[model samples]
Structure formats: structure tokens, C-alpha cells
Target: MNQSELRELLSTEGLRLLDSLPAWHSSDEIVRTIAELRKAGHSPGLVAAVLSQSKLRAKAASKFGPFAERMLFTEAGLEQATRLSVAAQHAGRFSKAGVKWVADLGCGIGADALAIAALDLNVTAVERDETTAAIAAFNLAPWHNAQVVHGDAESADLAGIDGIYLDPARRDARVRLTNPADWTPSLDFAFGLAERYPTGIKLGPGIDRDLIPDNAEAQWVSVGREVVELGLWFGTVARPGIRRAALVIGDHGTAELTAAADSEDEAAGELGQYLYEPDGSVIRARLIGDLARQLNARMLDTSIAYFSADAAVATPFATCFEIVADFALDKRSLKKELASRKIGTLEIKKRGVDIDPATFRTSLSLKGENSATLILTRVGGKRRALLAQRTTFAETSAATA
Candidate 1:
């Protein structure tokens, strides 16, 4: 018996064969099982199915054929599989503006493809693996306009697509990016696509700022306070300012926001009565510079991410905090005060210093029933941490920067 024979066994008697094999996690076990099936005289399809269905590769096996085996299990796949909201965001960017013909290049698992199709856009999804292509087809079966094509996208004919969304293989199917560039879409292909149409390329947060083409508009995106993916928009959609987007999902619904760059004068002078902290994406995109002006807030520290102003001007970018208490670093005094109150739950936040929150929590030996939000960082070139509680003043924020 050979590979052909083993495959036959699986097609004709898959359940029977599965029960007889020992459980294992390694690909080696699958190889060994194939060998055993061959010795027992199985068919090629049976062998293929069995190997593909092995626990180690069950998902890939379920979704793809042999060619897709290279996809392997990966973090990116898991993220794509689990984070439907993120994919929907990518899709919404194009679909919301009435772009109907969308191309989802490198559409792994058809996550973004499904999202675009759900928005009533006709999508052409291209994948390099037969298995992944097949799986994508199955995933898009409900959408009449969603088609999955098997091939390399770089050379694929994409003449009619009105808008293109590219989610490059930022990581191997196993999801670890040994070299970040290894998973990125080819720069030439990406730029070409952007030059041709309204295109968005998904990128890792660690992408170099300098690498972004001057003609393209770059955005930093964060979802739920976690900076997830960066996006580059080109062609007709490109703009000059950096875009920061934040997404907030709540019980009622979802809220998304995008803030562009600002050139307002920096706020100076004394610490105001209120402090505002912008969303991470806003801070990263330097949208806070504009947001501060809108909120009438000034920078607390030139380099610090926090903002301060005398009056509160309502804005979505920053969360306003009524200044509760500000003090210098008096470890002994603070510890004694907390110890007397039996403050056990200590929250430490710091900027500029390499202090570990855990060590500080331990050192304080704070044991108290009262809980407080702590800010640990340098203020005006001094090292200190502030303690406060969350206020009703919510900074409706998103994850896109």
C-alpha cells in the first residue's frame, strides 16, 4: 500500500480508521499514520483525508486541500477567525462609501471577503492555496456576488474591481512573524494596486513610518484601546494627514471615530484643574495636538501623552479627569497612609520610568478596601504617580489611529 492506498481507506472508512490511530499533536504522528495506512493498503484520498483531519491540522484539513497544507496553524488566522469586528472595519471602509466591486487580495479564510459581501459589495477573493480557495468559496456560498479565485494575486487579472483591500500574509499560517516583512504584501504589487484604484493595505502596528509612501495616507487603528492594525490608503482615497481611528463596542452598539493631524499651538503654563488623556491611536497619530486645541487643553509634558487645561471642552478624543490630588514621590508617607487604610489593591501607572508595576505594588504593601486609579510617571521632569478614580467623563474612543 502507498499514499494512494491510504487515501482510499480514509474515503471509504474514515471513521473506522480514525478510531484505530493513537492521539498525537505532531505532524510526525500524521506521517506515521499515513505509513501505517499504506501498510494496511488504503487509497490516496483516504490517506490525504486522514492526514488532513489529524488533530494537529484538523482546521486546515477541514478548510483546504493538500496545497493549503502549507498554511499551517497561525496566530493571524486565529485573529482573523476570531476578530470579525476588525475585518468588518476593513470592509466598511470601502463598502460604506458605495464601492460595490471589491477585491480582497490574499483573503485568508475569507474573513474580510465575507465582511465586504455582507455590506452588499461584490467581492472577488484571491488566494494562492487550493484548500484556502475552496474554503473561501464555501464561506462565501451565501453571497452570490462573492467569488473565490485560486492563484497568486500579484499576477492575477483585477481589471474591474472598483476598490481593493489587501490583507497581506503579515504572518505565516502559524502566526509568528520571524521577519515582519516576510508576511507583508509585495510593496510593488501594493503600490501598483493603490495606483490603480481605491486600495487599503492592512499592516502591522510595528510598520516603519518612513516606509509609508508619501503619496499614500497612513492610519493607525486601535480597537477597544488595543492598537491592532495599521492601514495605508492610496489612489483616489489618499490624503495628506495621518489618520487615527478608534472603535468602541458597547452593549448598545459600536462607535467608530477617525481624527486627522493638527497644527495648533502647544498648551503651556500651570497644571490645569482637569487632565485629559487621549485614546492611544489619537496620541500615536498626533491627533491629540488638534484634539487639545478643540478641548482647550494644553500639553502637560511636551513628550508625555497626557493633556491638561483649565476648562473642559467636550471632545471624543480624550477622557477628562477632574484633578483629584497631585503630590511628590514620598514613598514612606504614601505607604503609611495606605497601610493605615489597609489599601491592598494598588494600581500603578508610570511614564518615562522603567518601574515595574508589580514591584511597586509589592513595595507599598498597600492593604485597603478602597480602590483607586493610579498614574505613575514624571511630571515637569519629576517622577511621581497619581491616584484617582474613573469619572463619568467618558472619552468615546476607537482603535483606529
Candidate 2:
């Protein structure tokens, strides 16, 4: 959103109109709402801006929850903003460390700063974009201890601040930048702050492992099975004896696997009765072996992340599936077998395979009463398919414990 549009949205009348609008449903509804507002004598800019923000607020609900309803967001700022649940975890790190003041460098829309301020810590939220900085100021205005500044994070004075949280701009003109140096407030500069202050740097989960500092505690966080962000905790922010961690947050609550160093690879073995798919965070954090050892499992292949165990294991770090049938990697034969067994609903999961599950399922022409999951991956250097039944951790734990 531009400065003028943002100014209008923050106005008393504009905010009232925006709040009065119903939750966004479809494109037709938005068009109708826009027309109604325009016919009501609202200025074209105000109507357009309020309608756009209404749509964005609906979209932002998944990230910000109730706060999205009251906040202003730009397209780019909303895209880059951290999820509120995840931001709370970041804030917890500082609060637990007794940090009284923090500098949130490159803060977009002040999502992280909101969490930090909610923890009762003083926050200086800095954004380089003038428009985004203004929106951030509005979002953070409710917090008496928080202030938004329009300036370069690289030049922000960190004096007297107990900690620094840096989320560098990892995108350029809507495209995600893969190289660390390509990011605004580059990784080098963000990391340099570690030497002078307690710092936490947020990065993408797919960041190069070699680029991570040896002394820093690197963590990969996944929410609901998707790896979202990588957090690097430096100096006092780093947890003792934990250099690498995989933090998974889901319906089951938070589970963490930490190690002093990267976990070693487990030896590949024959397919067992149960197959396990490690959480994306564990794979990204390179802690699959640690999870494997916990579950008494072995890797399905030397290069793949899938694991096999002889018994039903209850672990939050992985999804366990009981093997019902194993077959050679042949589509026609597999289709015939599944058809013969009257298997209809299918969940096709793959790793180390080129087949697209949707296309492959269409080719199967499935029609049956039974439902099963199919895992397509290599086992002992050969492609194989395993028809399996998913077992929940709660169920398995109750039976096995």
C-alpha cells in the first residue's frame, strides 16, 4: 500500500468502514462491496484501500489471528511477516533470557515487535521502507514501550539494547533470494552483531549448512508439518549445550530434538513392518538420525529421509505408518493388486521418485471401498512401493506404552 492509501486507512472514517465490512468471501463479494462503498460517497482511494485491506486482513488471519483484524498490511509486508505463534517463540527467547530491551532490525509491519512488546520488553522496530514503517507504527502504537523507526537497520544504534532480532529482507521484487549476500541487511552484517550483542537471526529453512557459524545455535522450526523458518541464536541467546535443534509445533504441542552437533546418518536396512516419515523440521535441522535412534528405526535408504522400524513407535518427530503390503515399483501391477484388494481412496507419498502422485493416481483409475497410503521411495538402492495404514502417535503410544 502507498503512503496516501495507508493514511486514509488509518483515519477514523476509513477504519470504521473497513471494520463494518463483512469478512471477505470471494472475488464477486469484494467487487459488490467495493461498488456499494463507492456508491455511498466514499472517495475512490479510500474505498479501494479499505477493500484491499479487508481482503488482506482475511488472508492474514491464519498468521496473526485476531490481531489481523485491527492491523494494516502491505502486500509485501504481509508476505514477509512472521506468523504470530512463531513470533511468540522468538519473543520467549528474549524474555526467558531476561532481555529488557531489544532492537528488531528490518521489522516488517512490526509483527515480531508486537510479540516482543507484549512480553513487556522495550522494542525499537526499524524498517527501511517508509510506507511499511508507517504501517508498523500503527500496528505498534498500542504498545507504550514499542516504537517504529524508518531507517536502515545496518545503521541502527544498538547501545543499551539487551538483544537484537534481525529478519533480513530475503526477497527482491516478489522473488525469494537464495544467496545470503543478496538479502538486505546481509547475513554477514547480521551475524556480525553476534560479536557485540546477544542476537537471533531468522533465515529460510533451506539455507546452506556451511554458511552457519559453528558457535551459533541453529534451529529449524516447523508448524503443522511444514518447515517455516530457521533461527540462529548467538551468544547469550544460544541455549547451553545445544548447537542444533529441530522444533516442531503442531496440534500435539511443541517437541524438540537437540544435539551438540549434527546427527550422524543411520545405516540403511531392509524395510520393516512400520515406515516413518520424519518431520520436515527434523530433516532440515539434519537431526533425522537422532529421531531414528529414539524410535529404534533405521533409514530406508542411505540418501532418503524415510525410516523403518520393526514395532509401532510413538514419537512426535515422525509420522508412523504400518506396512500392509510391499510391491516392486510397477504401476500396472500395483494398480491390479490395489484393485483386487478393493482399495479406493489413496494417499500417495513419495521421496527419491520422479512420479507425480496426482498424475499417477489418475493413471491407476482407482475404484474400491478400501483406503490406504502408498509410500514411493527407494529401499536398498531400488525403487519400491509400500501400501501402509497410518497410525497416530496417541494411538500407538497408548497401545505400546
Candidate 3:
């Protein structure tokens, strides 16, 4: 949004209109709301701005929860903002290190800053865009210890800051920039801050491992099975003896695996009763071996992420499936066999395979009463298809008991 639109959105009248509007659900509702507002004599800009904000707030709920209702957001700022749950963890790192004040560079709608302030710590949130900075100020207004500044993050004054949190803008013109140098404030500048102060740098999960500093603790975080971002903690913020970690956050809570170095890979072995698929964060952190060892499992193939074990070992690091049958990779024979068993609903999972699940599912033209999961991957250098039944924790427990 532009400067004027943002100003209008934060105005008394604009906020009143936004508050009066219900949650935005679809395009039809938005059109109807626009017509009703226009008929009530609201300006086109104000109506548009308020409606846009309503939609943005609705979308932000997933990231910010209840706080989204009271905050203002720009499209780009909202897109780049960290999830509140994850940001709380970041704040905890600073708080635990006895950091009383922090500078949140590239704060983006003040998400991380908000988390810091919620812990009763002081935060100076910096943003380059004036509109975003204004939105951040509005979002952080309730916190007495937080403030927002519109300026270049690299030049932001850090005179009395106890720690730093840097979330470099990784997108340009709505497109994600893959190279570290392309990020705003640049990786060089962000990393340079860590040399002087305790710092946490938020980066994309697929960041090149070579670029990571040797002294820093690199962490991969996943929220609800999706690997969200990689965080590099340096100086005092880096936990002692922990150089690499995979943090998984789910509905149940959070779990983490830490190591001084990459875990050794487990030996590839024959498929057994169950198959385990490691979470993305575990795979990204190269901690799959740690999880495999916990389950008493081994890799299904030397080069694949899938694991196999003789017993149903429950673990949060991976999803376990019970092996029902294994067969050659021929589609015709597989289809004939499935048809004979009256298997219909299928969950096709694959790794180290070139096939697209959707296209393959359509090709099968499946129709039956039974539901089953399929694992299509390489086994001992040969293509194989394993039909499996997904096993939940409760089912496993009941069966073993």
C-alpha cells in the first residue's frame, strides 16, 4: 500500500469502518461490502483500504492469532512477518541470555518486536519502508518498551542495544530472492552485526550450508510439519555445545534435536514391518540419523530419507506406516492387484522418484472401498512399490498392548 492509503487505513474513520466490518470470507462478500460502504458515502480510497486491511487481518490470524484483530498490516510486511509462536522462541533466547534490550532490524509489522516486548524486554524495531514502519508502530503501540523507526536497517543506531535480531528482506518485487547477497541489508552486513553483538539471523530453510558461520549455531525450525526458516544464532545467543538443531513445533508442543556436528547416517537395510518418513526439519538439519537411531530403524535405501524398522516405534520426528505388501514397480500389475483387493483411496508418497503423485493417481482411475498408502521408492537399487497402512500412535499402542 502507498503512504496515503496507509494513512487512511490508520485514520479514525477508517479504523471505525474496519472494526464495523465482519471477517472477510470470499470475493463475493468483499464486493458486497464495497457496494454497501460506497452507498454509505465513504470515499473510494478509504473503503478500499479498510476492506484490504480486513482481508489482511483475516489472513494474518494464522500467524498472529488474536493479535491480528488489533493490528494493521501491509501485504509485503504481513508476508514477511514471522509467526508469533516461532518469534516467541526467538524472544526466549534473548531473555534467557539476560538481554534487556534488542534491536529488531527489518522488523516487518513488528512481529518479532512484539514477541520481545511481550516478554517485558525493550525493542527498537526498524523498517525501511515508511508505510510498513507506520504499521509496525501501530502494532507495537500497546507495548511501552517497543518503538518503531523508518530507516535503513544497516545504519540503524545500536548504541545501547543488548542484542540483535535480523530478518533481512528476502523478496524483491514480490519474488523470492534465492541468493544471500540479494537480501536487503545483505548477509555480509547482517553477519557482521553478530561479530559485535549477540544476534539471531532469520534465513530461508534451503540456505547454503557453506555460507553459515562456523562459530554460530544453525537451527532449522518447522511449524506443523512444514520447515519454515533457518535461524543462525551467534555470540552470546548461541547455546553452549549446540552447533546444529532441528526444532519441530506442532499442535502438541515443541521438540528439538541438537548436535555439535551432523549425525552419522544409519546403514541402509532391508524393509521390515514399518516405514518412517522423517519430518522436513529433521531432514534439513541432517538429524535423520539421530531419529533413526531412536526408532531402532535404518534407511530404506542408502540415498533415501525413508526409514524401515521391525517394530512400531512411536516418535515425533517421523510418521510411521505399517507395511501391508511390496511389489515390483510395474503399474499394470500394481493396478490389477489393488483392484482385486478393492483398494480405492490412496496416499501416494515418494522420494528419489520422478513421478508426480497427482498425475499417477489420475492414471490409476482408482475405485474401491479400501483406503491405503503407497510408498514408491528405490529398494536396494531396484524400483519397488510398497502398499502400506498408515499407523497412528494410539493404534500402535493398542496393537502392542
Question: Which is the leading candidate under TM-score?
Answer: 3
Tens digit of per-residue lDDT, candidate 1, span 1-401 = 23453334334386466545554355455566677788888766766655554453444442333423332233235345424566677677786556779888888768778778888889999988665666567568789989999888776777777998887775564565645456556766787788778999887766766677766666666655666677788755554454444454333245545555334447554567667777666665556666677666777677777877776555545566655567666777778766776667766666667778788777887776887666766677786656655545333232111
Candidate that beats the other on lDDT, 1 or 2, i.e. the better one: 2
Candidate closer to the true structure by TM-score (higher is better), 2 or 3: 3
Candidate 2 structure quality by residue, lDDT tens digits, 1-401: 77799889989999999999888766556667768888999999999998899889999998999999899899889988899989999999999988899999999999999999999999999999999999999899999999998999999987788899999998888888888888989999998988888899999889889999999999999988989999999988899999999998888889899999989989999898889999999998888998998888899997899999888877778999999989998999999999998998999999999999999999998998999999999999889999999997676876476
Q: What is the per-residue lDDT of model 3 for residues 66-147, given as tens digits with 9 covering 90 to 100?
A: 9999999988788788999999999999999999999999998899999999999999999998888888999999999999
Per-candidate TM-scores read 0.72, 0.96, 0.97
Poorest 10 consecutive residues of model 1 by lDDT?
392-401
The predicted structure with the larger TM-score, 1 or 2, is: 2
Off by over 4 Å in 3: 399-401
The reply for model 1, stretches above 4 Å from the true place, is: 1-76, 96-98, 129-131, 173-181, 238-265, 311-315, 393-401
lDDT at 328, model 2: 92
Arrange candidates, best TM-score first.
3, 2, 1
**Local distance difference test values of all predictions, in order:** 0.65, 0.91, 0.91
- When superposed on Cα atoms, how far off is each prediction in RMSD? 7.9, 1.6, 1.3
Model 1 TM-score?
0.72
